[model samples]
Target: MGERANKRSFTQSGRGGRGQGGGAHRGRGGAKGASPARTSALEAVRILRERDAFAQDVMEKTVDVARLSPEDRAFATRLVLGVVSTRGVLDEVLNRCMRTPHDVTPDVRDALQISAYEILFLDKSPHAAVDQGVELVRGIAPRAGGVANAVLRKVAASKASFPFGNPAADAAAYARLHGFPAWLAARLVSDLGAQDAHELIKASNEPAPLYAAVCAAKATPEVEDEVVADLEAACAAPEPVEVDGARVAGCYRLAGGRALLDGRVKRHIANGCLLVSDAASQAVASLVLPADRPASFLEVGAGRGTKTILIQSNAQRRYGAQVDGYVTIDNHGFKTSLLADRASDYGVHLEEALTGDAARLGEAVGDRAFDVVFIDAPCSGLGTLRRHPEIRWRLRPDVVTDHARLGLSLLESAAAHVAPGGMLAYATCTVLPEENAHVVASFLKGAHGEGFELVPVRGQAAFATRVTSGGTDGHFCAIMRRKAL
Candidate 1:
C-alpha cells in the first residue's frame, strides 16, 4: 500500500516547449503512506514494459480499478504517460548504464523507464525519482531490485548525455533516442520533410490536450465553457480550457484531465451529454455533415459507439427533422450492442446495428443505398500520442502498410454502398501518408477512381496542421462523390 496524498493541482503553463523536460513532481501520500494510486500508476508502467502492453490501454484499464485519490490518480497518469513519451531516450540511457545490459527483465525495465523518464522529462529530483523507482521495483519484483537500482542510478548520473539524432540521416540513432520503430521514423521524415517530421516526433512525445464535447442537446455554445469548467472541476483537472467545438458541435478542451476514468471525472462525464473527443475526431465527423442538409448516412467502424453519438448529435442540430436515419456497423457483436445502447439513450433510431466487416459492409446494404458512408478506418493511432503516449514505443512502422491496405479495402467496400451522387469519406487518426492521403491516392489509382471524386475538407481553420502548431489530433479525411453510373 503506497501513501495517500491530498489532491495535487496542475496548471496550464503553456505548451512546455519542444524537446524540453516538462515533467514535474507529483507529491506522494501526505498522511498515512504513499497512496495505492501512485503505486498502481508505477505498476502499470512496469506492466507495460514487462508485458509489452500498450500504455494507453493499460493505463485506461488500470486507472479504472486502481482506487486512487484524485491527486494520486492524476500523478500516476502523468508518470505513466511521461515515461512512455520519452521511452526511446530513456532506453538509451538505461542501455548505457547496464553492466550486462541485456540481463534486465521486463518488470525491471518498466521500473527503470519510469525513473529515467522522471529524471529526464519531469522536474522531480533525480535522487528522489530514482529512490522511489527502486522502491517500486522492490515491492513488485524483489529479486530484481539490485539490478533496477543500479541501472536507474546510472541513468540518473548520465541523464545529461543522451543522444537522439535525425532519424532520416541516422535511423539507429533516431530509434534509440526517439523510441520509434525505424520504419516509422523513415516514413515520417520522408513524408513530412525533415524538420517537420522531427517536430512531429517531438510533439508526439508530449501530453495532448484533453477535450470534451458539450452535448448540444443539453447545452449551447455560450454554456460550453461552463460545462467544460464544471467537468474539469469535478475531475480536479490541473488545467482545463475550452478549445474548440467537436465534430458535431459544442466541444470544449479539458486540457490536462485524464480522458476517461477517475472517481471525480467518471461522475462528470456521465452527468452531462459530454463526449470526450480530440479535435481531429470532431473535425472528421464534421466533414461528413458540413451543411444543414439531411442525408441518409452509414457509419462504418462505430466501435463503442462514441462516433455514432457525435454524428446523430450533429445531424439533429444541423438538419433537425430533415436528417434521415443512421445505420452503424462493426464486426464485433459486443460493439454493436454497445452502439445500440448508446443510440437508444440519445433517442436516435439507429436504422440498424449490423454485424459485418468494414470492407464488406456494403454487401449488407443494397446498391447505391446510402447518401454518405463514413469509413473511419483503423490505423496505428500515432496522432493521439499525447493521450496514448505508450503507443510510440510499441508501434512498428510495418503496421502502417497493413493498416493502409485494410483502410483501402474498407474504403473500396464502403464506396459500393454509397448511392450514386452521394459521398464516401475515408479518414484515420494516423498522420502517416501511407495510412492517409497516400492510401486514398493508391485506392483512387485502382478501378475505384472512375466512380469517385475527391472532395476537399471544408473547414481549414478548425483543422490543425501536422507541423508547428499543436492544436488538433492527426487526421486525414478525403470525401469522394459517387459518380452517377
Candidate 2:
C-alpha cells in the first residue's frame, strides 16, 4: 500500500476476526471444489506474496467480491489474517515436514501454509485441515497433492514440539514461534526487555478491540442520550473506556460483532454522531488540547481528519466553543480533501486545509503562527500490529531510525509556527524508542527546540502506552511550551 492508503487503513476502525467458529466443505479439485472460505483465503495469500499488498485491503476486496455467507466471510477473514501473520513460523515448521523444502513451488507453498496455520494455530479438526489442504494444493498444482498430504500430516503431528526450541533462552526461537523476523524480535528484546517484548509480540497477533468516539461538536446531553440509545438498539453494548482509573468521557468500547454493519451504527457514522477510533488515540487528542482554549490551532500530518474532529470535540466539551482559527496540512491533496469532507461532517470549521509537505512549513503556510501545533508524524506503526498484521513482515529494520530522523525534521519545521508561550505536541503510533523517546531527545537539543521547554501531559512527566491484549494500541505523546517573548 502507498503512504496514503497505509495511513487511511491504519487510522480507520472496523471489526477484525479472532478465528471464531469452524467447519469444512468437502469436494474434489475445481472451481466448486474445496471450501469457498479456504479458497478465497488462498487467493488472498497469493496476492499478498506476489504484490506485497496490505492484508486488510486484499481481504476486504476478496470477501466483498466473493459474496459468501456471514459465517464463511468471517472464516475467510480469520484464515487470511492468520495465515499472513503466522507465515514465518509456518514455513519453518512446514520445512521440517518435507524432505526437500526447496522443491516446493510458491503456489503449493501457499496452500501448505494455509493448512499449517489452521492445524497449528486455529482449533480446527486436523483431519479436515489435511483433507482440504490436499485438495487446495491439487486445485493449483495437481501433481502436488500427494506431497501436500504427506507434509500436512507431518505438520499436524509436529505441533506439540513446535517452535522447536526454548523461547526463554533464545530470541530467535521466540521469533520463530511467533512468526516474527529474528532481527525485530532481538531489537524488541533490546528495547523493552524480554518479558514486555514477549507480551507485545503475542498481543500484536491477537484481534484488535473495536472502539468508537462520540462526535464532541454534536454531543449535547440530549444528543448523547440518543446516540447511546441507538448504540444499544443496534446491540453494540457500548461501555465507557477508562485509562488510569478515569473514564474517557465520550469514548466507548463496542462488543457487538456486527455493529460496524448495523443500520443504526452506519447512520450515526454518516451523520457525524459516531466515529471509529482507538481509546489511546482519543486519549492523545484529549491530552494535547490546552487547559485554556486557544484562538488558533494547527494540525500537521492530518490524515482523513479523525484527530481533527477529535481535538475539536475535546475543545468543545471543555470550553463550549470551537477554536476560531483551525487549519490542517497533509502531504497528499486527496487526504486534505478527505479531511475537509470529514471536518464538515463533524461540524468543524477549518480556516484552511492545505496540501504540502510538513517538513517545510514556511513554504506551505507562509510563516503563519498558531497558538497550538500538533504533529501526528508518520512512523513504522509497530504499536498497531494487532490492527495491521502485515506490517510486521513488510517493515524494514533501517526504516525505524529513518522515521526518527524525519520526525525530528518535521518537529523543527513545526516549532517555527508555535506562538510564544503556546503548546507544541508530538505524537506517534509506535512502541520503538527510536521513533518515540529518541526523536524527542534529538529534537530537544536542536536549534528550534532551544526556545521550548518540556512539560507534563495528563499529570504525567511524559505519556506513552504499551500494547495490551484486549486493551489499547501502543502510543506515545509529549508536550512542550515555547518561551514567552
lDDT of 2 by residue, 178-280 (tens): 8898988899989998778888999887777778888878767688788888889888899999965667879988874477677877888898888888888
- Could you tell me which residue pairs clash in candidate 2? none
Candidate 2 local lDDT, residue 193:
88
Candidate whose lDDT is highest: 2
Candidate 1 overall lDDT versus native = 0.64
Q: Which candidate gets the maximum TM-score versus the true structure?
A: 2
Error of 1 at 132 (Å): 2.4
Score every model by TM-score: 0.80, 0.91
